[model samples]
Target: MDVEILSRIQFAFTIAFHYIYPPLSIGLGVGLVIMEGMFLKTKEPVYEKMTRFFVKIFALIFGIGVATGIVMEFEFGTNWAVYSRYVGDVFGSALAAEGIFAFALESGFLGILLFGWNKVSPKVHFLSTIMVTLGSMFSAIWIVVANSWQQTPAGYKIVGEGMEARAEITDFWAMVFNPSSVERIMHVWIGAFLAGAFLIMSIAAWYLYKNKYQDFSKKAFGIGLVIALIAAYAQLVTGHSSAEVVEQYQPAKLAAMEGHWDSSGAADMYLFGYIDKKKEETVGLKIPGGLSFLTHQDFNAPVTGLKAFKPEDRPGSLNITFQSYHIMIAIGMLLISLTSYAAWLWRRNKLFEKKWLMLVFVWAVFLPQIANQAGWFAAETGRQPWVVYNLLRTSDALSQSVQKEQVMFSLILFSLVYLVLFMLFIYLLNKKITHGPWHTDSDKHSSRHSDMATELSKPSSQS
Candidate 1:
């Protein structure tokens, strides 16, 4: 492979791994605010204990997210110098705003949120929690805005010649609110919320299954379920909205996503399929004209297909884009079903009674994470060939001086380092889960004693 391929793979690997945490951090940040707010409103000790326990977990996620995230910025300059220079002026403004509006507020309040428990008044601590949540969300806004601007260039003009060429912001706010930004931002925010909510529910489900901290787990699961329910439905709506935006601005990507090749007819929405690129045919289940109705509210509306673009201009690999997109959609539908069923059970006061359901919740923790990653894979891969829509071809954006060997070596090192980090994360997370929320020795002792009694009452054959 050449430097461009190696660099792309290296960046993709780092970004994908790094992505795991931010959504969790963003999602968990929202959970923290709600948990803390409940404590404030009800003056309940259990709520405070829950808030404190999760705050520790949130800190762990935030620390790793920040650490892993710094590498991407350096990659931009080292691996894709041309790309960096091209978008630097635009990215600079957005990132600067993130530093000022998002990072500053989140970090300043973070200390209070983590360690200000008894030292600060309850109201003050609650305010800090809210600020931290807002900060994380605000952080997402600028990042998505910058990325979306690449998908749909706006309020910018090319201002140099040859290798010195770059885009300069002609209108700052217009650049910030680029055509695709608002929709993408909302889509990203909801995905993060779902990630965080599911993590909480997964942990809570495990606790409930083990018959540990019943009251606390119940409360936590209830809150997580509520958020998951709302976010799941909201994602469906935003997913549609985002798709519409893609249809209008990046139809080739949309075509690649659905594996549609012909421009003479309406597009079919595949439930699942395999694309045979050699034959240029997709075989599997599909709804006739489903995409057309979704995009144009008419079953026979013509949606642009891959045939509309030159072969070189289309997404480089359509199968990857198609599969990634379908995976995301499948997970989204699954989540909606899961949340709706869980809600029904909760309403019937039978949620905790179902071992099967709680078990599903425990494993379902990974679904949102998968969905988030898949969504990004689809978006980025679908935009292939063009790192900045019509403005900059990805091939033209590489750092000419970089070598394949250097990228390969760095990729190996990054893999090893990230493996260690991942192991550490799992170890810490497991340690915390196993420890449970034992505020006092008595609480721990009583919970253990209760577990022993419950076990003793079970059938000996099972034991």
Candidate 2:
């Protein structure tokens, strides 16, 4: 109804859709390195085939991630012109660093990694894979640094310009390692890794269930399960640390997430409940003293509540924040359990033969994606009224000149385009998986090429 509300909706929709691809790209990049590295080590044709098959998939995702991401960058300037101008100096430097250190390096090596199978030596090709993977991670680093600067307002000074104030970068290193950067980056990368690992396991589990490519599926599942388990466990630690940072720096947001209304010592953690903000109490189960221990590592420590601050200063929809956080945590725990069970089965040499379990794994591939989206919702929605924490209100950040109808039209267009792109991606990926690699006869051709070239150059074998 309102222009500001419409603008917020448009941005959120675009960002959420765009987010789906990048984590897959980053996670798949790491998986590609692992697959290719194993091929080099074992000199196995199956491993090489696996690498080639998935690299094609990775290339498609990388392209989509880049394509979708470009639109959001443009929106920053077009829809949120004032916000862009205010944070431009800080954002510009970080973005420039991303282009120079990440995008360029990754793009340069990508062609070689994709097309140099027979043209380059194995060692050289492996080097290219490493570069691409690191480049993806480097890209994430700079982007997170820029976002974290907004969250914590570090490495910058506000300069008064006319009536409004603009931020200027004052300490470059401080900006890179802002208060929230380390925890956020760690949480994000681990989520990416989990997304990639689960994807591989899902496909492999399907193949195993159908009794196709049994050996390949077995190896793929084993490797994927191990990586998934480790990443999920590491995420729990990082998530806790990130929550601690939020408690200290963004108490209102944290208070909203836990549905805390009255400040108290030895707070209770609501395990499953609906909080009636009007009544100021939870409607279901809660674990007393859990919140205090979680936040401060002590049972009787004091934790802030929403009542501590003015009502208007609070972030959006406490119910949404609480539900999203709990759902994400539940999914994370489920991932750990599933992978752990898979690992135990692997140790007993029974994982590949479990038909029901394999089927579950096939469908359960979507769980990590759901968890990833929910986690993002909890973080962004939890931040509420402030676009840059207490420094800038979201209402003041929107472009004054843009019409509501314009935002609505663009939102409709974006949704249709993204839906088509998603369908195409799924179709192409399924085609690649079904058809297998281009060179299934890789072993036969391995020595044939070298021998044929050598003989052809040796005076026509005059004997």
Candidate 3:
């Protein structure tokens, strides 16, 4: 493989791995806020116990997210120096805002959130939880704004030429609110919510399945189900809004997403299919004119296709883009179905009665993660060859001094390090989950242990 391919893979791998935690962190932050709020409103000891338990897990996720994220910043300078220089001013402003507005607020309140349980008043700690959650969400805003700007460049002027060429912000707020930013931000936020909610539900369902912590499990599962059901439906709206933005600004990507090949016509939306790139055909089950209606609210409205763009300008991996997009949609629909049914059962007071449903929920923790990854794969891959949309070709963005061998070696090292991190994370997470939420009731103890409250509530257990 050439330098470009290797560099792309390395960055992708690192970022993809790093991507796992932020959504969980963000989602969990929201959950924390709600849990803590409930404790305040109802003065329920159970909610406090739940909040405390997940606060520990949230800290673990935040630590890992921060650690993994630093690598990508360094990679920008090491592997994509030209790209960094090109977007530095814009990204700088966004990141600086992130540091000031998001990170500062989040970290400032984090210490209080983690250790202030005994030291501070309940109201003060609850305020900190809200602040921390807001901080996580604010962090996402700047990051998504920066990324969305790449997809739809706005309010920037090109300064210098050739190797010295870079984009400078002419209007900062304009750049921040660029065409695609809001929709993309909402999309990402909702996805994170689902990730966090599903995770909670997954664990809660597991506890219920094992006939442990029945009260806590039911309450936690109910909270997760509410968030999941709401977010799942909201995703549909944001997804459509995002598609509309893509159609207007990045028709080529929209075409690639749906495997549309005709130069101009109302496009069909595929439910599932195989794209035969060689033959320029997508053999699939589809709704005829479905995409056209979605994008234009007109069944016969013409949508641009891949043929409208130069072949070299088109996304290189049509199948990957198409498949990843479809996978995201498929998982989303599945989640909506599951959550809706779960909500119905809860409403009927039969949610926990179904052992089969509990079994499914125990494993459903992975669905949001998979969907999040697939959504990212589609967005990034569909915009391929352009790291900064029309402004900078990905090929031209590499650090010319770096060799493929160096990239490959670094990639290998990163993989090994991340593998160990993942293993350690899983081990610690499993240990925490096994410990279960601290409980006063002796009957709720697992077969493997007694006095879970005494064991899990120790100061040392905050890790």
Error of 3 at 408 (Å): 0.3
lDDT of 3 by residue, 78-171 (tens): 9999999999999999999999999999999999998887667778888999999999999999999999999999999999999899999999
Report how far residue 347 has shifted in candidate 1, in Å: 0.5
**Candidate 1 residue-wise lDDT, 1-463, digit = tens:** 8888889899999999999998999999899889878866665667777887898899999999999999999999999999999999999999999999999999999999887765677788889999999999999999999999999999999998988999999999899888899999999999999999999999999999998999999999999999999999999999999999999999999999998888788889899998887887799899999998999998888889888899899998799999999999999999999999999989999999999889999999999999999999999999998999988999999999998899999999999999999999999988888888774332443333234434544665376
Report the poorest 10 consecutive residues by lDDT, candidate 1. 445-454
- Per-prediction TM-score: 0.95, 0.94, 0.94
Model 3 clash tally, residue pairs: 0
Q: All predictions: root-mean-square deviation over Cα?
A: 6.1, 4.3, 5.3
User: CA lDDT, every prediction?
Assistant: 0.91, 0.83, 0.90
TM value for model 2:
0.94
Q: What's the C-alpha lDDT at position 268 in model 1?
A: 91
